[model samples]
Target chain A: MANFLGLIQNENMKIYRRNSAKVFAAILIGLLLLGALIVKLNAPEHPTQDTHWKQSLQQQNTQYQQALTQMKDNDSYQNYYKSQIAINQYRIDHNIAPDRQMTLWSFVENATPIMILVISIFTIIVVANSIASEFNTGTVKLLMIRPISRTEILLSKYVSSLLFSLLCLVVLFLFSWLIGGLFFGFSGGEAHLSYINGAVHETSWVLATWQNYLLDAVKLIMMVTLAGVIAALFRNGGLAIGLTIFLMMGSNTILALISQYDWVKYVLFTNMDLNQYFNGQQTRNDMSLGFSLIVLAVYYVVFLGAGWLFYTKRDIKA
Target chain B: MGINTEPQKQPAVKLEHVTKKFGSKTVIDDLSFEIYGGEVFGFLGPNGAGKTTTIRMIVGLMRMTKGNIFIQGHSVKSEFKQAMRQVGAIVENPEMYKFLTGYQNLVHYARMIPGISKERIMEVVKLVDLEDRIHEKVKKYSLGMRQRLGVAQALLHHPSVLILDEPTNGLDPQGIHDLRNYLHELSRKEGVAVVVSSHLLSEMQLMCDRIGIIKKGKLIGVETVSDFMGEGEGKVRFTVDDGQSAAQIVKQKLSLDAASIESDAIELAIEHEKIPVVVDTLVVSQVKIYGVVSVTQSLEDRFLEVTGGKSVG
Candidate 1:
């Protein structure tokens, strides 16, 4: 077991020592910090004026009171009271508590797919290349002849790639947070932003507090693991990363087309993100949690298993 | 897995009709030989003549197409772990992580072999005389230094048998000389069975106790340096009076056609007793005998004959 651990450490050192990987990691961290700084600096201040709904109600109340006050001289009190009653009745009928129409946590919940969509596309390249580079450089043989089992070597690579992916996410989140906070502020207001009707609206929804960054890190790890498995099984980093991006991007289109079939939702990439499951979003096609979990497990197993089997049985002569 | 109850073992390595093929090409064809305990046995063969393939099979890197290889009486196929436990090998080229320091590479390999100690690593470092440069990364080391480091790594576990394939491939003349002397001391003083495979006959002729010549995947011959020199093993040569008459007289008396008369000398390929008989016959024949000398066949002639005059480059 110690020998195995030593081999794993050696494998990890090889990855960490690479100049290109180090540069990539540094760039990611820089981008994340930059993004966070930008967001922090550019966040708009909350509107100081009264809300439109509140202003409308105030205006109605003022108009009604003035009319009643002038009715003693003009005999308009009864008509003015009737008008106020009519206005109140209209409010009641329309149920216009528009004051309570702030963005909810539910909005952030629905946006989990977008979050995974944005991050995983970039993650595919990092994860895939981490393993595929060994094959490309003919360094796999050096690692294999160390009396360590193939499974251990593959697992070490998988774990290291996962760490790299999480690091990338950390960089991105740090930059996004800094940027988000710079334009916005450290305050939770406008944690979620949306563009509707050519106007950018700040949402009160706050999904990632500083503490939730850990969970974000774990989620990034899971995504990278999926990509790492694909990378290890594929010929090179490019194909693995390209295919992973294709799956993430084409997932919605595929789901739309496959929704006509009863069983297709179980395999959709959008459904694979665990946060999506918690959100109670409707699938394009109905898929039970049990079924999706099984499918994902199968995929994880096949990807990991195929990588191990191929690496072990491969001719290391080259 | 019982120890051979026999009191003493004859040889450290023995290959019994070991045949191996890669696809349709026979890389090693029905090879059989032995290396006795504590001797530097040289395995001489040309490029693509199955030296590397045989070493790989012996080290359990590749399985044989047929037959078995035994190290210290443990079968390479069936008892590989046990057999490998006693044997150390560096086949073809010696390569290590250029990024790792010499000490790091040695320690890494040391950890793989069970029961290896840090002290053992230090010992090997000193043995290879790389103590000063051991901490430097391999990429900074010269070719000779790297080869020494390779030998150090292979010897770290103190395996009884060391197999080196073309150990001097990339070294300068001084480096080769250093290696040759070092290997000789290791086998002679430490009593380790060292098997060196090379195409250079002169080195083997100088270094090996006995040699096995392989050609086109076949073990063509195995002979002691003396036997390989043929019937001229310790026999005296004669520059005698009337060299042709001496040859005729000796051949007529002994009834053997082993004497060849040159212009100046007669080479009497004779047993110890025949030397006395030849001198008396020449004296009785009234031939003016000028000199009596012993000539042995050169290593080149022996090598050429053993390899059947096959081209070696």
Candidate 2:
């Protein structure tokens, strides 16, 4: 409906109008360009010099085997080396290139987590402040007295925060692509060798990259939703942002500390890293992609429900 | 001006026994009142008297625990969208998005309601006389300018009822005068039922056609401005050649309390109907009265009397 679109537009205007938002965007883009420049300067001029697919695959396999022997007691390190050896062996057997060039796509693929992290931090701030600032500044009454329902207003705010996060992701992707292409040169093929089902498989580079981005977005979605809930419940932007960032930055450590507990697998943070599933890595031995998706779905619903219920039912006294 | 031109028309806003309770504490207790079209109704109350609470309920920002509010016949409880569509309110303060320009804030609000046009926005801007600085961000605006912009935003949709809570909280004399004239014109010309709550009794006395006084979550009185101030007997001050003799004559002839003699004037508290009798007695006694003036009680005095001397905030 036009009304809902108008609401979203209004919320977006409120977000983008702030000078801090503009400064944050500029900083993000600048950081990405700087990162690209650093990567370009550090890359070797001829990375694939005097190396064929068979030679390089043999070299990588030997290195991984050496590391695997040294870290045999470490399950994570052993699994990493095993997967690397399997993929290199497959590439050699199939006569596939080792993707030696540091292409733009490769840079983007490698920087996916960094991009997700930046966007998540930015989104946590945005979403947390979205509802809380209105109450803090006593502007919630202005929005509530309008003809639209409270749910509609809160939904628009949620949508606007997600849209901002999506915008950041898109900008980061495009900017990285452009900067990386200028520096590293666009020289990679569309095929990427990935280890899946205990074997190396040739997957479409674009599909894998997009899937990685999508998985990264899952974490962003959960974080932004939780921040929104905090903003609505606490009505304090500083507290919401502080608590969300603390939870977000400490989630991995917390997950690791509780990994031995069976119930830890059900924790939202443990399931938030959908990128593990993409890389054929299980966060927990019992955790599967289906189970993670289900956990995320439940958290998504609960977060959204709590945010909406508190916003709609709680009185706007301030 | 006539309060309501059409006596048979439906009330613009009707609150039926509205009650608001906050965790075992009743903020508004069974409050009921109606504001008809083409009248400026002043909501007067002391601090913690539930004026803002009642306004919040009427605007749908706060829910009533025991009653319903109707805006132009649409019940706020069941048909909030419809009820709210006919109402525009600024509760407590006109806190807008300070990061946004004045025009942008109005545009943002306009998007929520259907059928509001660019011309209407311009019209409201001009109505509030913010045409010159409407493009500037609200952070750069003065408090008075912000209040005017708030009024402009509230009037954009041409709602049937306009509710302003403490609208004149921070304003210069000129700004207050402008706002008072603007609200009076809005109610008289556009038939917009305006409900304004304020602790400024003098301003309310000048602006509101009728007033509703509340104290301790109760509606103590509601009446026309004149009737509200003229509820009890008024003081009759007789300026005469001899104040002492006139006071003695008023006390003896009118059977009233002893008149307070000050210089050449004798003041006596007497009923409105007894003014002529006192004048006749003074003339019969050849007291040579220079002037006889009846001084009605001010709204503040009457409000204090009605609310048991609790000061209005």
Candidate 3:
């Protein structure tokens, strides 16, 4: 285990020692601060809470119920309206506010999705070249001659790339929270209404925020793994990074087009969004939350397995 | 360099019928050889003769299609880590991370193996004579400096076997001479078995204690440097005022064949002993010999002779 950790350290040294990695870190922080500034500029000066919010939410739920009665069962927008009504009812039942507050935690949560995508892109760009760059520079010859096994070498690169992504995420989370607090006064952030399993429940804001970020990162994990496989197979960094980024940006449209078929549920992108089950936003009814998790797990194994097989079995001609 | 030491009984590296194939093409035929400790083994072959491939297999960068290699009595295929722990090799080029400082690159390799201290890293840096610029990035280094740094990295763990493939490529003349001396010292004093591969016979001639010549993916022969160069006869050149007269006088008086004749020189196939007799006869016949020099039969000449005049790539 100690031996393996040293390998990881060596791998991390190669990663963070590159000047581009420092530049990426600086840019990620700058973007987070800039995003908070933009929100600060756009926020309303004062927020008002309605005294009769429960009565208003009750009227909205009645309107939502009538709209649902007139809509088709498979209407894509049905889930959105259903979740909204349930969350509103929960708020009124618990006598909690509607959570339309301009606060630190709210801003942190809202910024997470975009920032996660940015961080994913940065991580992908770095990892795509991790294995292939060694071959390109002819350094793999020396690296492989070490007493460590090739599997361990490959694992170290994979883990280091993930660690880089995690570092970016933690930085974004903490910096966004601090920046949002400076702008929004860090109040009214305790209430977090969560819609789960066709019911609404009040959850802790910090836990909810972390869950939101992690769930949003599922696709990034899958795409990064795919990038690693491509890198191992082709030994070409540019091709791997380019193809994975294209697939990532185009995944939604691709899924929408094929989501009508039963097999589409098994497609990698379709199951990548584990949040679909939690957010009441799934496009297909064929896959349950357990089913998506299983599919994603299977794909993860396949991706990592393919990478291992190629990295270990194939002779390094370079 | 000091006197060449005799190779010890224990072999540090052994290849038994090792073969490598790429797709349907065989790159290395059934090759078998042993490099004993305290000796420098030279691998000589022409272009496309699988020198690089064999190095890769020995270093575990490439897999052999058949047979196996043993380093310090550990099978490379079955006990890869144990086998590799005894070896330090630069398979082809001594390519380092140009973005990293020389010291950082050494540290990067040091972390891969256990029991290497910071003092060891510094010691290696100093040994390679890169201590002055060890903190500078490798991108600023010369090719010779990078080669030295590679040697430093390979020596950090004190492995019993050191393999350098074309280690003299891009090196200055002084650098090559220094490396030759260093390799000799490593084999003689430290009892390390060194394997060096190159197509340049001149470099191999001075540096190698024993050589194995490979042609068309097959090893033709392996012999000590002295025994290999001691074959057949040597050429003697006669620089004279009249080359035609020198050739005529030498053929008539000494009965030695004048291999070729230039305007002011003549070359003769003669034994080392007959050189004085030829010089005496040339002088007696008033040939006016300006110079009589024996042209040593170089390894390049011997290589050509053994390979049947096939070109060296």
Name the lDDT value of residue B190 in candidate 1: 69
DockQ-wise, the better of 1 and 2 is: 2
**Model 2 CA deviation exceeding 4 Å by range:** A44-79, A97-101, A188-190, B1-7, B237-253, B258-267, B271-293
Check candidate 2 and list the clashing pairs: none
Question: Model 1: residues >4 Å from true position, as ranges?
Answer: A37-147, A163-185, A189-275, A280-283, B1-17, B32-37, B68-87, B114-119, B229-301
TM-score of chain A of each: 0.63, 0.91, 0.93
Give the winner by lDDT: 2 or 3.
3
DockQ of each: 0.15, 0.82, 0.82
How does candidate 1 score on lDDT?
A: 0.64
Assign candidate 3 its CAPRI class: high
Provide the TM-score of chain B versus the true chain B for each model in turn. Answer: 0.79, 0.86, 0.84
| Predicted structure with the largest lDDT when compared to the true one | 3
Model 3 TM: 0.91
Which CAPRI level is candidate 1? incorrect
Residues B62-127 of candidate 1 have per-residue lDDT tens digits of 668788888888887677657777776676667776777898877667766667888999998997
TM-score, model 2, chain B versus true chain B: 0.86
Per-residue alpha-carbon lDDT of model 3 for A1-318, expressed as tens digits? 888888888888888889988899788878878887887788666767678889999999999888878775553567777888988887777777766556888888788888898888888888888988999999999999999899999999999999888888888888888888887887666678877778787788788888887897788788889999999999999999999999999998887787667788788888888877777766566678889899999999999999999888989888
lDDT of 3 at B126: 82
The C-alpha stretches of model 3 lying farther than 4 A from their native spots are A46-59, A70-76, B1-7, B237-268, B275-292, B304-313
